[model samples]
Target: MAFLELHNIHKSYFLGKEEFPVLNGIDLDFELGEFVSILGESGGGKSTLMNIIGGLDRNFEGEVRADGQLLDHKKEKQLDDYRRGTIGYIYQSYNLISHLNIVDNVLVSLNMTNLNNREKKDRAIELLKQVGLGDQLKKHPNQLSGGQKQRVAIARALASNPRVIIADEPTGALDSKNTAEVLEILEKIAAEGKLVITVTHSQDVANYGTRIVRLADGKIEDDTRLKPAYKTTVEQPNVKPKVLSAGASYKNAFQHLSYNFWRNSLIMLGTAIGLFAVLLFSGIGNGVNAFIQDQINSMINPNSITVMKNPAGKKMSTAKFEQSMSQFANDPSKLLLTDKEVNHLQNLKHVDKVEPGYQLSTYTLSYNSKNANGSGFQTWTKAYASDTVKTGHAPKANQIVLDKAQAATLTSTKKYKQLLGKKVKLTLPWIDKNNHPVQVTAELTVVGFTNGGQTGAITGTNYSTMRHLLSNAKADTQANFVSVNVNNSKNVKSVAKKITSIKDNGKYTFGAITVGDMLDTVNQYVSIASIVLAAIAGISLVVSALMIIVTMYMSVSERTKEIGILRALGERKKDIRRLFTAESVLIGLFSAALALVLAYAASLGLNHVLYSIVKFNMVQITPGNIIFTVVAAIAISFIAALLPARKASRLNPIDALSAD
Candidate 1:
């Protein structure tokens, strides 16, 4: 039994089942301390035997025994372990990863070992120094000369401390002087008591090794020993290999991403633009809804439900209730509530008090030869928030609180407060009990002013003052609607429902309206608009994902040789998959971060510009939105990279290494 034994190896290639035999009954033996050269011609099957011993070619008619233990090439994991622990390959091409420096390239093999980061770096540096290229540790492969590149590859193969160093034409590309330097390095490696197997076409190169086996037409013609095996001298520490961890995969992925960042940045920018649009539209919708609620709640009491005589004597939906406002405008007399109807609502459960109010469709206020016509005149009740009156108190007898616009008409906006104590003539067209139209007028004092920051800004007066004026004009004095104040705010909804349940002779008599109902209607519309705009903006994200897919496929094509290097270095298929997926995910995260920055900048700028007009910030991005954006970005990129990553992991190492 030898240190490594090959027994009767037979191999063939087939072109559509036409078998072409390459290796014919090849039997070989080797030891740990000898530098053996397999000297052969182009088609002499030397490379095929090397692939079998290196655990790269599994489909063959052969049994490879390493120190009397049979090498099971059929089991992929065992083959991977064999390659990681026993075999180190130095290719003719030098096969250095273009992106990594000399030290990092060597560390690629050392990464699979159970060494800490500091120990790995020290060992890689030592290996580079041993090859006489320590000063070029930070230089990439393309920047190095042919000799330097082969030295880096040799250093990398030696990093994992494998027992058998296999050099497949290691000095094939170098000149005489550099070739002598490389052969010296290989002899030194054999002197350290490791098996140095070199495959070569040059007779002079074979003569430099300890033994040369001449092969002609896939059969060994002669085996010659030029020198004795070097005695084992230096002992090495046991380097236990481990599977590639996710963190290492991500680090590799990030390095590749950074190297090609200028190309990937366009994808990130497109994705960020889409994500920013979604964030912006959603933020604006939230801001608009909040602004409307603030404006409405500031002027009206949320706990009070406005009670109106249902024209159809049945409960109406909010949409129907809105449509009925025109009906109220058409016949104010028919919509008027009588004393008995008002009392019926006042006595209901949870009813604090029902304040009978008149809502005039249109009214005119004149003062000192200036007039301002407005609409939605009503008698003020507890349903109105006290803060609505900015200048003075609520209306007293023969007094009215004008909308700020109406007061500003009679005087300058700066001097409008001066008119609070001034007398004004209030007039509106009304209907008599006989259904005849009449002009109702009264000279009143302006006690306060209101500015609701929305449309339908109307003048307000007390019930008694409006009744007195209507009576003086011989017009109808009945209240059209009443504000039903609930004792507790929480019960407002239930009480409003109870009011609708009230009936007269099998017909519903009243309909109730709360500030919540109106606000809910407004919020619903805003939410729909937000979703629609965000969905439209999301189209660009699809394009970005497609871009990522195309980019990953292109990466797979470009890094085919790198994939072969990693596979040969004992990285698992799953590791290759995760490497590509991790890169795409990083792209997603970077895009999300960019999107957030853009959204915030745009929102801040717009809010600043429009703050004076709306008196509020119109865009608000929440923390939840930020989190959702990041998660969405990651998911999209990960999913987009799946097929490409799978394709990359499934590539054949032999084919990939042969790719240009």
Candidate 2:
């Protein structure tokens, strides 16, 4: 039985919607140890017949059998095994991997082979020596001469030790002398009892073969055995291609990972920066939101609510009827709230405490050495009717409490402390002559200071002390402010809304804000920041995506002829795609991991700096950030690699082999 057979094969292509037949029914058979040459003009279907025989093109309707075994179309793995184990292909351009050394280039075909590193290295060296490239094993493809690179290509083809060697214009790129040398090698390969097939236009190459098969218009016009059957005495031991173990390809990938570090490094750099931008922006937004909330909480009194009075600016009295219409009268303050009225509001649901706060702008204080004469320190005083005190116990009737900073400034000199027990002179310079500079001497002790030392200060003495100082004179201290404390801090707003109904009845007109409301405002600001940060992050991702696209495109171009060689060697369509995608995924994963590490380091630096300055502890880096970065990187890489990977998978062996 013949070693290889092609029976009644027909092939066609579609030019748009129209059918374009390239090959008519063709038949051929070859035995082991035969040197066969197929010669024809371009587009005469010689290469197409070779493609069908090599199992690179499956579009043809045909029966291709080898060694008496019927080649089943459904058995794709079997076909792959047949191609890997039984066939060797050499291209015209000597498609050696540019990035790999000669030895590593030869081992490229063994990516699917089961051979270990040492054994594969040995086999690769043996093939290289046989092809006269033993001394060039450490050299890159670019370092080799054209003939030398072709010899390296021959070695790569034979690394898997297939039974048949298929050459498509293998000597096309070499000089006449090198062409003769390559043809001599081919003759020797046939002499080793292996079937050798050469597809070429050169009669010189065909002359070295034992048989010449001429193809014309997709048909074999002549199949002639050479007159003398050109022979070579050189013999090589029969070697079989290695079969890879389960998951060996993936394992080998790790072994070869760092071999292309430059490409991987660039890809990793792009991805790392993209992830860094995303995480840094998002984290900053969160930190800022938390900071804002803390600042608001520290600044405002938790129980305070603002009560604004309606304005009646001008007086208009046209007639007695207008005077009778007291609805528009500027007498809202005439019905001043009594202590009973203030206590009535204290009885409302969710009200844990309440206090009536009075603010007077004209009161002033003076010390022996220093004097702060601005409108009563620009602060407020509340009657401490509730049990809540920010600092020490609520002030007694004759005592006062200054904000922490104010107290500290006032007590800076020894004479200022003397004013605490002595008659401290005070004046309401803006008020009428009835309120004079009263020397109200009293036993005044400094109660605890209000307003936490960190936040801004507005709290001052209580109304009990203020009214007591003015007991000899009558003045209206019932001006309008009510502080309400809710049972639960979160329910402040709900109770404030329920109290809004009292405004229509002229009992009160006030607005309330909860800590949640303040927090919500802060969150809105942070959301805007997050959007800005996200936009910046998107820019980095865009840059990363562009980089990946360019890198993969360059890879496709650089490996164009190599892909053609692989296709000719019987790599499946899926295998080609898997190889490129595997490369992309690895690049993405490496970049993401690097980015996470960088982010963690950045967070540490940022936290340390912030703590040193504001004493505020911030910056949180979580494991989720790492996971998110990795997933985002992989997604971007896959997206960027789609077109190039598909292009690589769809490459036509003939066109790619013809490309530079």
Candidate 3:
């Protein structure tokens, strides 16, 4: 059987609905070691016939049998294998990838092979030597001469040691000297027992072939045999090239993008800065919220629920108030929360402890031969009478614990120790039923000092002496409010609900907020800021994607001849598409890496500024965000490349060569 056979092949095209027949009833055959050349004028359908034979175009009607196996149009992988392993192609325009060196360009054909990198490199160098490009193995395509580039293309075609070498005007772009060099290489390839089929318009190239096929209007018009026979054979080596995984392939693509850093720098930088801005804003907002919550925690026990009077005024009028005494200022019968109410609250589920508290503000006291003003002070005379001294030694009738700021101010006056044990005479501004200043004197012992309170600015006073002084001189009100501490924080809300029910008439309402609630509010606020930031970052991401689209489209246009050359070499449309898409995905991944670096730097700067304002560190970086940024960038890249990839895959080898 003939090594290759085509029986009455027919092909056509659709031109605005009218069928244009390009090839009709064409028959051809070739044998091993035969150097054959096909020659025709432009638009005569010579390139189309080559494309069909090479399996790049399968839509045509044809019966192409190779080595006695009828080529099946339905099985794509079978055709792919045939293209990758059984056929090699040389082109008029060199089709080496600009991003790869000569050796890598050749080795790319063996990417799907099973050989390791060393073996693939060795085989690639051997092929390059055979094509007279041995000295240029380390050079890129753009660094080589036109003839040298064509030689590299020839070496790449022979990298896989295919059974056939298909040449489409392989010397079309070279000078006479380089053409002779390339023609000699083709003649040598055929002499190794392989089928050398070339399509050219030059009679000089045809003169080098052992047999010549002439075509006119897609028909074989003449066949001629030249002088000496060509003999050739290619030894299939035991070693082959190995294929890289998807991840590794993209990594290589990223490396290529990095190598061209200056070209894509602005896009990467812009995207990185945008992402950083978003993260920084979110972090600042979080830090502020955390600081506020901390202030609240230090002043009140997280497990304690404050029971205060819900004033008849606006709901928030008493919301942020200091402990007040009006909630208990009622006749025993009118009060929903009397001593009986306190006993009842102590019995509630999860109730660990309770303290009845009452207070009077803006009182003045004299002590230690010095007078200290208690403006804005809270006096708890009726609440926790003996328990206060039980917790800590009772504040002496002559002693007191000054809030740190208050003590500091008093000490700054150089009268602190003198005032600690001195008699601090009390003077209440409110008059009693007797319409005289309600006054009392107590010797206060300075026990300890406290600086922080609910607003992160309050001073503390021991409850005992303050309460004793209040009881000795009747205050405006008694202990009308209570503070309850629960053992289990989870039960605080439930217990508060039950207590509120007991005072159902709203005469004595109780309200409580948990630390967990504050934490949730802070987190929700931060999350909202994060989403807004992501949206802003998205704008930069979109710009990056557009950059990728523009770059890929330009690449496709500029590499049309390269894609055509690949198609002539038995590379399917899928291969062309994947190559373009791979390049785009690589660009996106590189940008994402750049974005991460910038984000980290920005976080450092942001933390410095935020800590100054809120006095706390707040940027929280998670692995999930890193992964999301990368995935989002890559997905955007892939989507952007779709149109360009499709354009490359749809190119016609004939049209492509004609453009040259």
lDDT of 1 by residue, 34-124 (tens): 9999999988988888888888888899889997889887888888888888889899999999988889899889988999999989999
Model 2 has a clash total of 0
- Sliding window of 10 residues with minimal summed lDDT for model 1: 451-460
lDDT of 1: 0.89
Using TM-score as the yardstick, the better of models 1 and 2 is 1
lDDT of each: 0.89, 0.67, 0.67
For residues 1-660, could you state the per-residue lDDT of candidate 2 as single tens digits?
478998999999898999888889999998877889999889999888877787667677989998888777556667677788778888786777676688877777775566767887898898889888877778888999999988988887777767778898898888999999998888877877778899999888888888999998888899999853334455554455544442543443333456668766877887788788787767767676767666665555555443323232222212222233345233434323456556667768888777666544444444455444433322232222232245565556655554545544555633333334433334442221343233332334555555543334443455566655545444544534566767675676768666554553543433344556557765887879787877777788888888888887887887788777666666766766666666777778888888878877887899899988766656665566567777888898878888888999888766787788
Distance from true position, residue 251, model 1, in Å? 1.2
> In candidate 2, which residue pairs clash?
none
TM-score per candidate, chains pooled: 0.89, 0.66, 0.78
Tell me how far candidate 1 lies from the true structure as C-alpha RMSD in angstroms.
3.3
lDDT of 1 at 362: 86
Q: On TM-score, who's better, 2 or 3?
A: 3
lDDT of 3 by residue, 10-29 (tens): 99989899998889899998
The runs of at least 3 residues in candidate 3 whose Cα sits more than 4 Å from the true structure, single-residue gaps closed, are 17-20, 72-79, 227-234, 238-252, 293-300, 303-336, 348-351, 359-448, 460-481, 487-510, 522-539, 558-589, 605-615, 618-660
